[model samples]
Structures are given as structure tokens and as C-alpha cells.
Target: MTAVAHTSFVIERDFLASPARVFRGWSELALKQRWTDCHSDLAGRTHTLDFRPGGSETVTMRFPQGGTCVVRFHYFDIVPDRRIVYGYAMELDGRAGSVSLVTVEFAPTPAGTRMVFTEQAALLEEGQDLAERIEGTREGFDRLARELEPAPARP
Candidate 1:
């Protein structure tokens, strides 16, 4: 059998919240659904997250065109308030699809938490190029940074 080759992308973002808060946002299903999964034009989509080793996260995104894609992540390790390591895959109607490794690290900062995310993925039959996928992933993280920001206080 041929082995799955991988490509990676790294992103760093600073949040104006405490490490614990940021970690909670990353781990908690409710907070994650707020900034994630619910964005973009995908309506009526929902996500379920089980934030622990051997736990799993599933997101089903529905397009306006009546198409749907489901993505799943199986957690391998979780370090409280610090890091998460997981394996991910995408499927259409429960069929085998792309696979990847995802790692997120959180570090305490004077302002708040410094969050870093890295994803290494293998293109399955879909055959997406590494560079294009990495660029798109970076954009997704950029959007997440904006989504996570709290509203500015009025003068």
C-alpha cells in the first residue's frame, strides 16, 4: 500500500483574552461554534466537539446549493490550557476522504494568549496541491482571528 504524504501550514494569532479563556474557546463546543463552523455562507450547519484524547469533532457544512460536506477530527492528545494534537479527515456521505494531522498550541502572553495552529494534510483522491491548500488554510485562520476579537468599547 502507498503511504500518505503530507504538507503543513502554521498560523499564529494573539487574542486579547486570558490563556484559560482562549483555551476554553478552543476546546469548548459552544464557543467554537460561535467563531467557527457558523461563519461563511454555509447555513444550517452545526458542529460537535469532544475535546479530549480519543474524542472526536464532527462538522457538517451545508451550502446554499444544497450540497453538504462533513469533516471529522479524532483527537490524539490534549494538554490542558496548552496544546492539542489530532488526526482529521473529510467525507461526503460517510465515504473515505482526505486525511491530516492538526496541532494547536497556546502560550500565555502579557496581553493574553498566543495561539499557534499547524495542520499537515495528505491529499486523497481529490488531489489538492500543497501550496494552494496551505494558502487557503492560512486565510481561514486569518478569518478566525477576526471572528474571535471582542467588540471595541465605546468611548
Candidate 2:
């Protein structure tokens, strides 16, 4: 029998930008591509986003070694520059792998914006575990930090 495990985790980060700017990084398509895995070195990869309540986002990438992985996100609630709640599922080569509900809250700080991310997930026996997911998420956020950096003014 296949086993299903449940887990939840939270990560918080502060950005040196306004809450609106930070929120735009997630809501804007071009900006999101800079931080997310939309630029992976995969063949036949595609990413589409519709950032609104009840909207959906999908990303598919085929690994060079073998197999394809797909992630689909369905937005449940969105409060511009404040909060977002979404549910997502992962599939490996057309087989169901895992499902998760995620919540992100943005708050204004004296210096900039603070974001709190919470994810509750169910892992299938054949899928990755919570620790791996956490690590990947941390790496993604690290990339986001770089993406959020301001560009230098042209001479």
C-alpha cells in the first residue's frame, strides 16, 4: 500500500522594498519569471500564470535525464499587497505526486516589507519529503532576493 504523509512549514523573509513592490514580484508575470523556476534548463518547458483569485498557474519541465515534472497552482484568495492563498499539486510524468496549500502574507516594515510563507502539504510515498521541499523553497527564496535587487542606473 502506498503511504501518505502530512506536514506543514513556515518561512519568513524581509525584503528591502515596499510591500507593493514585493507583491508585484509575485503577481507580475515578467517579474515572477525572474525569481521562479521559469528559466530552467529543460526541454519543452512552459510556464503560464494568471494571478488572481480562482486563477491558475502551471509550470512543466522535462528533466534531461528523464521524466517530466509539472506543478499546478490554483489561487483561492488574494488580497493585493497583503495576502495570497493557493493550493497546488505536483505530478511526475503524469502520475500524481503531492498536493499542498500555501499562504503568503506581506506586512510593511520600517525598512521595507516582511513576508511570511506557510505551506501545508501531503506527500505520497513516491514523492519528495517535507525536508526536500523546504530546502528547494529556501533556494527559490534566495533567488527571489537576488531578483528583487534594484538595477543600476545607466550612464
Candidate 3:
């Protein structure tokens, strides 16, 4: 049986803002925090993003039960207003665990930008299934969609 698998999702959002503005939200720290970090339900979690090739990002999710998980990503490619490619790994208190590849593409639309995200993950340990992981990822993207809804008009 194959231990590696790929999962893909396409998300379209109508932004009152232009594609350039939306793309900036993906690459800038302050803009990313507005949509992503502020919307996270996990308490006390912190996110650090470095937007550049060979840069890295780390998100630490702290649990009320005194446990924490850190997600780390190493940026491989970054194109302004277009795409981002990275390698990701999850760690339990700094111990490396599962690894994956992620690609995010942004295309200009009549209204805004259509974003497509794809991930290829490998289960390095026994008893982990790709289907389960992919389903979780799909749910995550859905949550992102909710978080990124367009704002009301500014008077």
C-alpha cells in the first residue's frame, strides 16, 4: 500500500479588495495575523511567519491540558502575488514527526483571486492513514474560507 498521498483543495473568495491586496494578506505578517492567527480557536497559540525563500515559519498550538504541538514550514519557493511552495513538518514539543509538501497558487479573477492549495504528505510512522489526514486538511481549508470572508463597505 502507498504511504504517501496528495490532497488538493480550491477556494474562491470574493474580496471587496483587489487581488494585490488579497495576495499581500497571504505574504505579510500583519495581514496574515488579521485573518489567520486571530481566527484560531487554540488558546495561547503563537504564529511566526518568515516570507521568503529558505525562510521558515512556526506555529505553536498550546493545549489547555498542558500539551503543545508545533508546526514548522520551510519555504522553498515564493512568487509575489502568485504562489508559495513549502515543506512542512509537525513536531510534538520540538520532536520531528510527520512531513509534507504544500503548494498555494493565486490567480487573478474578474472579482478577485482564485486560490488553489495542494498538499502531498508522507506518514513516517506506522498506523497513520492519508485519508484521515486529507479530510482534516479539507476541514481546515473550510475554516479558512469562513475566516476570510469579505468585509462590509467602508463609508
Candidate 4:
């Protein structure tokens, strides 16, 4: 027998940067690494991203205790500096963990840009960590904010 669950959530953030800058954070490999998991303890991690419509991305993370997490994403639609839609599936140590559809929308705001992230997921066995998942997703956006911060003026 297997346990399955469905959930969805939305996370929104405002960055002190332009929509183009914010969009590049996800589109560019180096920029994406600064905010994503290049800094994690995922040994032998492999990541590849193709940012155009119909393109795909794959990210693998290894856990210290046990199990490996691999996420594969396929882009369905992309509107530069506006919106992106993708569907992704996760495998945990060879076991299917979840599948999700994600949409990110960017809008010009007085402060700079407002990004809205929505994820609808179908979670599988041993994958009932919804709270942690939401927190991790939020943390990624936080890292993006830090990544986009302006450097201090040199003396």
C-alpha cells in the first residue's frame, strides 16, 4: 500500500530590483546557483537548465544520512520578465516522491518587482513534509533577494 496526498501553495515576494534582473536570477545558471542549491551538501550534484519554452532542467541533491533527491523540470511557457510555467517531478532515491506544476509571475512594483510563485503538488509516500517544503521554497526566494542586493560602494 502507498500513501498519497495533494497540496498547493503560493509564495510571493517583493525585490528591490527590476523584473528583468529578477527574471535573470532564474534563467541564468550562475545567477540561479547563487540562489538555488549550488551551496548545499549535495555531493556529486548535477544541474542543467535550458530557460526557453519547451526547455528542461534537472537538479540532484544527495542527503548525508541517506537517499538522493532528483528534480526534473520541463518548461511549458515563458514570457520574458513576466511569467514562467513549468512542471516538475521528484524522485527520492529511485522512488517517485512527487509531481508539481509551478508558475512564477513577475510584476513591476513601486519598490521594484513583485514575484508570485504558485505550486500545485501531488506528494507520494515518505513525502509528507509539506511544511518543510513550503519553508524551503520560501528560503529559495529569500536567497534570491540576497542574490539581487546591490553591492556596497567601495571606499
Q: RMSD to the native, candidate 4?
A: 1.4
Weakest 10 consecutive residues, lDDT, candidate 3? 5-14
Error of 2 at 25 (Å): 1.3
What TM-score fits each model? 0.79, 0.93, 0.73, 0.94
lDDT of each: 0.77, 0.88, 0.69, 0.90
How accurate locally is residue 80 in candidate 2, as Cα lDDT from 0 to 100?
94
Question: What TM-score quantifies how close candidate 1 is to the native fold?
Answer: 0.79
> What TM-score does candidate 4 reach?
0.94
RMSD of each: 2.8, 1.7, 3.8, 1.4
Most TM-score-accurate candidate: 4
Q: Give lDDT for model 2.
A: 0.88
Worst 10-residue lDDT window for candidate 1 reads 34-43
Pick out the ten consecutive residues of candidate 4 with the lowest summed lDDT: 37-46
Score candidate 3 by TM-score against the native: 0.73
- Give the C-alpha lDDT of model 1: 0.77
Cα lDDT tens digits, model 3, 42-68, are: 657788988899999888888766667
lDDT of 2 at 27: 96
lDDT of 4 at 84: 97
Superposed by TM-score, candidate 4 places the C-alpha of residue 29 at a distance from the truth, in angstroms, of: 0.9
**Candidate 1 lDDT tens digits, 1-155:** 44566667787878877777777776887767766654478756878888889999999987886767788989999998899899988875566567889899999998888989888877664555677666666665565666567889999
